[model samples]
Target: MKLPYLPQDYSKKEHIIILSILLLFAFTAFLLTIISTTGSTSDYVPLTNIYLGTADITHINVTKVVPQIGPILAILGTALTAPNRTLDNIFDSLKTISETPALVPLMYLLSNAQNVSQSLISLTQLAPLAISGNPATDTKDLVEISGLLKVSSNESQTLNGLKNLVVPMLQSTNTSNKEDRTTELTLDLLADSKDPLTVAKSLTVLNNLTMEEKMKMIPIFTLFGVTKNITSLIGSLETIVSKGDAISPARSELMLTTLQTMLASNPNVTMAFGTISSLASGDDEKAAIGAIQTMLEDSNNVNTTLSSLSTLIKSNVTQAESSKTSLVALSSIIQNVNDQSKAVTTIAQLASNTDTATTTAQLSALTEMLKATEKGTETINILSQLQTSLNPNSTTFKYIPSLFTLLDASADPPVSFSSLVTLTAWAQQNPQTFIPIMGILSDALAVKMVSEDQLTEMTPTLLEYLRIPVYFQLSIFTLCKRNLEKDILECSASHAVQNLDFRQIIYDALSASEFAPYLNALNIGPNDLYLEGDLLNREHEYVPSIKAVLAMNILGIVFAFVVMINIGFLFWMKWSSKSYAWVIVIFLSSCTALFLGLSCTVLTVVLQVIKSGTYKDAFGVVFTTGVAYSAMMWCSFSLMVISSVVLLWVGITERHLRIPYLMKKNPATIEDLENSSTEADNAIQETKHEATPGQIIRHSTDNSSDFLKNDPDEKQDAVPDIQQTNTSDSS
Candidate 1:
């Protein structure tokens, strides 16, 4: 039977195609209904609501029969698109679908298969069976399902589904609700599961929930004894740490963070403080350090937190002295603490205790603490005590190079200054031990001028310290020269000078009367200083010229003029006579202009490269091609190329057309010539009728003779032929 809109004359193929199109349109409409209804509950059309209700029922039935089809759908979706999928590809596909008018209706269908709320509800129901009392049989299934939940949580839709399924369960106080039962099963798995992998997976899933959801689960977790389970997990990690076995740092951090989240959310401060302090001296002291750092973040817990930390450190010096990781974590913790006096005193006590066996760890820990501590009277006092506490001849002095490295330009100005002053005193007192590090100190000073203005204050101290030894001055100058060469190649000339001003500062300082003995000893004078200034100033002159060259806008003006000329040429070609010659002229001019524009663009780029390479030395001049000029050249060349293509197309397609008015002939002259030819033909016809047939032949012969007489050689041949015809007639 034919459809109502289709004609009766339609063939079977036509009918099939029309029906298929109709089906696609209907499907797209249904997809729109689903998306429109799902996006808002209040705006749902009655028909759309019925449609969605039917879809959700079908979805629920399929999920029940398939058992965990949500995860199956997620895996299938990933597998189908995972081969070469990238963020770029996904964005491009979405962009194309949105931009195309034909595909806009189908855009909502892309995520239709991923609407897995019903499937998630089904999976939620199955959680108890997977988390049954039998670990051997259920652990694998529980881990797999939990992992699936974790992976699916990255999608907003799946995450919403999870929130809906799990949040209500955590909020529900009823013991008989299935969702509440599911929550209980999950918490039991966390508390009683022997496999660390199972516990870690469960914690990760919980961590992936929103903060509100976590807050809701905290009390439930506490009531289920999950907090103790987490603490025990931390203990296990600490055991693994003490045994020197490689444990996942992520797992350890997760355990501690989970415990912190639980306790911090709890209103009981005594329990939180007691729990934190208990873990502070455990084998996993890093966990306690993290917990304390979290507590310190809240201003209410700062005093209690610092008190606990101070107590732990004072009681466990041996532990703090041996663990480098714990030391670094502690240093980071106290870096931002408001009250540093307690932390400093406690850490200084650890630094003051030196033993042959633990000297290295203690020195490392003290250095980290000093680095983290703000530079002030407290730091100075700490350094003075360390100066006396550390043995002058101990092997711990091996870290002097590291200590000297703290003068780096990136370091805090106050810290670098303090370090420099302290090291200078040490050098003055013990030249033998600190002498070897003077070269390192000079190298760092020469590079320090490149930092921000705060570091410039160290210039006088650095210069005074280096002036004590002539070789130190030479080492600094040499380093400054090397750095000048490297920095000049990487920056503009002015920037390079500003960065390498340390050399100039040293030169100016040495030229003073206070350093006259040192300068005279080195045979340096005003001429040396003037020569250095001249070398630095010479590169500044090149900067203005380079800027002038780059600032030239002549290329854009030329391109504009060329575009205007091409526009006029286009009009002239169109309105004037059409011919092969005109076409050739247009094509050649366009092609020539195209190549010339292209050549200019390439030449400008080459000039930029040559200039950049030529001045990439002590001059430090970097040349860049003008982007606007380059764009203009390319655009002009592209327009010419298009013109040339069009000219060629016109020439080929209209090759058969006649070239009228080749040079200067007009329509009137052509009309006059046509009339004359017609009159001449009439004259020949009249001659043919009025005279004998021979007369007609004679007239034709006369006309042929006149045509041949236009050429010299043809005229001679025609005369002989006429004479021969006359002779034959006489015979």
Candidate 2:
């Protein structure tokens, strides 16, 4: 990677020299500024005056202040004379000069100097500082300027800073000279006050006051500054002492010592006393001080504790929104507890004594209830109070936490506050209904059997139904009972009925007595009723094997029917003529037997296994009829075998009995060959006179011989015979 290149400024040699000279001048001025800040009071102020354009050459000797004053005066004098001088403009030009720590004291000194007011007009232009300058500065100047500077030198820094703070405020406010006099008087009194730091802070507070507020405090400060009558003070103290209630001397002394010490440390407290006194009566001030003293003496960390609690409450807003009703009930329950501490101890015992698993479950239940109600604090308080009343080893106590957690989630206030209260008076009449009904509610809440909105909507109706002294839950259960008679396959087809979850609802209602008959009828027990798991997570519908078995049976019947048809056709087409037709018939018959037999076998095994077990709930009478069905299937198989054998025998018998008629027509047979032979005989008779040439010649020769033997004188006849023979031979 290439390095970044920096552009450099190139200066000519002459420019560099000029730059160096200018730098040298700046450095000299900076050194002079430092000297001017730290030197003697006269030396510092007069030198600052030069740069500030306030220097009067006639009054000050520059060389006396510093040997380099000539150069400084020369530069500053030229700059000062070049423009019309105004405090704002002069200050603007001098803004580049860095402020030094020593400037405060030098300015304080100049502001107090006599006859140099015009030169240092802005330094102490404030009424507060200007009025305090004479007497207050007299005391300081006597030590630092007129006499030894040691007496008040320790207090000078604080006093000077106070003066600096007041100057800007006094200058900024457009107040009349009368208001200025009053402000100056207030400052004069404050400067003379005991603690300078406290006085300075108080004076700052007073300096920031508006013209109206200053006018308000002037008369108060006037008495505070000039009130020096010992007799008057004695009378006022006497009046207070007489009017005030007496306390033990010990307490009085102790309180006085505490107040005195506090005054030294935080003199603002004394100002507070003065302010309160001015605003009210002395008695009121005493009462206010007592309150403050009591507050100081108290050690509770209420502020810190409340802050944390407030933060926790704010963080639980979302949770509270969901379970508003429950939280409200919990809060009331907590507040209404007679012995909160004892209850809390009992609840604690309940948790500690329970099994770890049970405890975890209870805690989870509590947490959910808290989320639902947004009443965590109230639930916690109730649980804490209930702790002392709970028996660790008691079974009832084991569910107490879970029960309370559930109750905390109740939506209806009437029911929540008094959980045992029913929707109707009938529950009061029959305690049994009440018992089961209450159990139902508890279970419903504990297991989340219903949603909050649902519980809210149905609480009254369900409560009434429960108290009606009837089997209300059976109504719901009957909706699911339609599947009781169905086999696994049938049940799966009708599985949508399970969506009602009547079983779970009955379980939640704690009224399973009504549903017991259905349970037994279906051959399912209470343990099979799922109370915890999700219904959707279960396979409530189809059994793949049962469906496959049903398909197989259907396919077998169809195949058997097709094979029987084919066999019948074969027997009909070639039964008597084709010998091998029996073979095809047997093959087809065997195939039909196999299909039927296999289907029956599968059905028998499956039905038997299902019937032998507790599958009545799933398969009902469908599988339970295995014995009868098996027998029927076996009979079917036998029938199929018998039919196939009969077909085979028929084919074989027909082939053997069938014979071709030869010599004479067999009356038993109706064949085309016999009819063809009869027709051939008739043809022979019709063509008997139609002889061939050889037969005709031979017949003529025989006839001619007989004529010659029978009549010798017939030589012409003989010749005719010969000539006929010759003509026949030629033809």
Candidate 3:
């Protein structure tokens, strides 16, 4: 049979060589089997004793059947040169491949590879499954686990196949979906490795407090908290490891939580308390706070640790009137040593909200620390948290109190105004559910030159966030969100400053110096209706007494308004310029309008741009926003077109719109005329003096008149006016 493609070089020589090799392999393999059956030789077997499920009788039968079908091996060579050999014998050849004892290891290798391929599909089904409400659901996806155990083949397959399957699964789970794919992969590996570390990591993941893991952990941890189930899991884990104190990494974390829980619920024995107190008592603050600091630093632990710290601090200390606060001063070493934002937030909330006497004292210590201390790790963390702590529903509502306190002009010996500036910006962004920050409101009304000058540290040109003029909301540009200090500044003023950084911005900026701290936290930006709240607050106001917005929520709303205006302005500019780059402008306008909703006048401009197509006409569209971003886009288009037209009329058209076909069709230059030289020559001859049948002219008046028309008027009489004659023969 002829084939579509054939190998050129292959010939009978190659076939003979292959046959010789195959015969040699088969003959040697047969000889080895004979010897192994005959004598008790130590080197009889190349592969380990990983025999398949069939007994030795089946192996003998497979061997007999292979020779009966041995002729099929001929097709393993080039099919064209050996056309008589065909895949019709593919089944028989497969039987030979199966029976070849020398190829046992390779056959095992491929079979294991095939299992890996099957695992790929199993993992596909497992991906979404792993993210199920509990780890159990993801864990039950046993297809991959079954593949890993390999009841069919054991010695040849390494743990490599199972080990790597979890990494991607772990990474894929990291999103709004809150999927914990890692836990599923880890659970599958338990059957293969049987290593305590593997089981421990899986257990710890199951017990994690994330929304995904919480359902699993909540039952376990709560059970641990209330009953003895956690103890059972712990005891089972201890028995598996057979080690008393050196538990696996996963189990250690669970144990820590268990310890914390036990401490809260059941007071520890005197000896145990003494041991912990000793650990906490180190004069070396680094050593004293390392463990607690690490836990507090994690975004996962921030809320938990903050609540714990607040409870701890309140229980241990009391404020006195006419006393200088010692909180920041006492904790400066701790704060300066750690870079945990949650810890910083925990400290800041407590430190900033102290009564009048303590506020002054604590404020001084914190201010001095921020100024002189090179360790801004804590400040960045705290600032980042304070930036996000603007949850309208928070019980303490730290943003309003801290900001208003900073804005309080009447407080004796004002604290560091610069540090508070950034903090105030954050509070403005996240308005509390209750209480208006009147102090910050008044400060907006009384903006001084010095305060504006202070904005030089962060790029004020980009952030110029407060331009929105909201009492609570602080307006900032997208550029200022480059760093923690600036981000906090931006986050603080979010109530007043409407533009929220998209996740893409954070994803891109994660590598940048400023916003790197935010990669691990959940700092969601609010947009239009921005609060789909039960109408938490409807009015916005700035209080002169405190120099801040009375209702920080209103400030956030105003910030959103200004953001709408900025978006509208940008779109309008792009539309007016008649730039093809309007695609990007379109995107910016969309995001802004979407954020602004139909409540801003910017939407009117945007809509007019879309409808009128003339940028000049967008001004008419400038109506109060009513949640219509599409309208805003049209308005922007109108403004852009109108502006472009005005610029053209004023002779400022650098980017001019030339008539499309006119340039292509019109002969504007001598080169163009020369291109139509035949037409030019024919026309020239036709206009010459007419030599009628009876008369001929040697000189032509038509040529002379045409030349005179083009000649200078001063030289018009240089040539005499010639009379036309058609007497060619006489001439």
Candidate 4:
């Protein structure tokens, strides 16, 4: 306790000394600042900033720093080179690990990690400067440089999101017989484990363990249980989540999964989900529930899991409503099949509660549960019962259109085009139920086009419904066809070309395929013959005017037939009686030339009319009328000309009374007639008694007799001389 210097002297000397030291410190500080101020600031922008009075200038804003600071840092770092021997040991161990063929990559990983670790130590060397000096950035840079060697997510973030060289392996939780010794060491440092070396040894034991050996570690985790290490695991979870690490989702998922599995086994991991759920609401709630639901859905303890879910649900009833609402499907999915009755009922209650949010997702989920009703009679019946409770329009059909959307996925069994078709089918099956959907479809059509696949998918359903009432088909045909255009345009870049086929298909389908049925049922035609002056009748005007142009051929034939009939009938009538027969003669003579002349004149007129230019309006009808009239005139003229010629010939022949005339055709010739006159000299007295003074004569008994009978024979010379005298006298 005795002091080498006396207390008072010691005090005075120390006080004076302390004052001198303080003064000296102030002086040197001033000198350094003055020197720095006098210097050029080509290298330091901050000095220029200080000169401008834009920033605070400082003493360490040195006019010059030792150019060798880089080597100085190296040399200073070497003074603690023995302390850094741990890094060497680490490097050598890493080298050994590297050269160890099997662990080489991991060794390189560790080597880089060692560099990062060394850099961290180097940053420690810069700590005083970082903490107490304006060069804090430099210190921070050193820290960052250490971290940049690539490792850890938090370290990554800290080190400008520094990566672990073997990041996937590094962040990965190893649970093998030969465990990740690095991870074990990290845990030892991180966890404050009771025996870090033992824990370290345990990590080595894990690494050497085969997959089978790794299996042995399960009980260890199982025994340690999730609850035992909940805090640490959650911390890691929180770290990953907070850092928003690139693999956060995956990492968090794994962490959560592990927590869930461990908790499910021990019935304790529910805490984490519970913790997460409490902070979340709405979409967040569903997510938390989803996390736990995945775990609980598979647990052997169905009751426990459901109870946990129910418990989780109760914590935030809104969340429970949400989770239950969401998990209803997932519940059905992963929940024990045996517990489905209970689960489904729970799901039904959640679904039925109108108080719950009707978000599209909620609506979708509720609809989906109804869709998934394939398993049990009880489940299906319950769903059916629940369906009855909601508004037919507001609750069920309100979302039937979404079912059509789900068709896009075209999942097998449930998600096929047929599934979408089924919705349409259901709409058709119960038209009243899905009428709104048609309207929705209409609106949808108005926005973007539908695809033909979608149309084809729904065609049967639409057709089936439309077939019931013809009015529906006719009215909806335009819609169906137009929407089909929309359908085709869905994929095409060119809207113009898109629906061309659709127009043809739909137009043809209704216009042609359904033409008869549609027209018949509606009692409509292009011209309404049956609509005779009904109230809706536009106007009624009836005038008997032949469509002469169209009917020209018909009219001509008809007139010709009439003329022929009149002629034939009159001829027959006249032949039956002489009084009528005279009528026939007069009729034929008067009408024949007139009809023929009229037809010829009409023909000429029509030919002239047809030769002119096209009809301005009525020329066609006028021309056709002219043609028909001309045809009638010509036909009459032709018949009359032939008839007149025949009658005149008959009269002339009838006036002649010679033998040839009796025959009227011929009696060989007139010479024969003259010879017959000589022969008649014998029979003339006997046969001269023909009626109307008609004469009959034989030409001769024989050819020679006719010549000789008129001439004198040699023995009849005397008779001939008398005959010659009589002949001369007669001449």
- Model 1 residue 39 CA deviation in Å: 46
| Residue-level lDDT tens digits of model 3 in 388-425 | 33233432232233222222321211122222322223
TM-scores for all predictions = 0.18, 0.25, 0.14, 0.16
**Higher-TM-score candidate of 1 and 2:** 2
Cα lDDT for residue 395, model 1?
35
Number of the candidate with higher lDDT, 2 or 4: 2
Clashes of each: 0, 20, 92, 25
**Where does the lowest 10-residue lDDT sum fall in candidate 3?**
50-59
Please give the CA lDDT of all the candidate structures.
0.32, 0.31, 0.27, 0.29
Writing each residue's lDDT as its tens digit, candidate 4 over 1-731 gives 11011111123343234324333332332233232222122223322221101000011101011111112122222321333333233223323322222232221211222222232232232222312323332223222223222222232122111112112222232223333333222222213323322322322222333443333323222211222232232232223222332322443344444555656666654565665555443553345445444444344553444443333223332222222232232222222233323322332233223222212222233223323332223322332332333223322322322222322222121212222222333333344433332322223223333332333333333333323111111100011211221121111121111111211222233434322333233233333222122211211110011112113323333333443443344333223123334345535444535533543454344334332311222111111222223333344445445545554443232211111112224323334534544654655445555524444343323432433343223111011122233344345
**Judged by lDDT, which candidate is best?**
1
lDDT of 2 by residue, 155-268 (tens): 232222222323332342334332222223322332233332333233233233344433332322222123233223223323323323433334334444555555556655
Q: Quick one: best TM-score, which candidate?
A: 2
Candidate 2 residue spans exceeding 4 A from truth: 1-419, 423-574, 608-625, 642-731
| Tens-digit lDDT track of model 1 for 1-731 | 10011112323353234324433332332233233222212222331121100000101111222222222223222322344533344334333323333122121111122323332232223223322344443233222223333333132332233223322322333333332222232222222323322232323333234433333322222211222233332333233334322324444444445555655578555566566556544455554444444444442443343433343333332132233343333334234334334333333333222221223322232233323333322432323333332332433223232222221221132322222333333333444433322222222223312221222332223333333111111110011110211111111112211222323433444454243433443344434433233324444443343333222223333433443343344333233224545464455535444444544444454444434432432222223343333444445455445545655554443312222321123333333333444565777678777786544254333423332233323221101122233334345
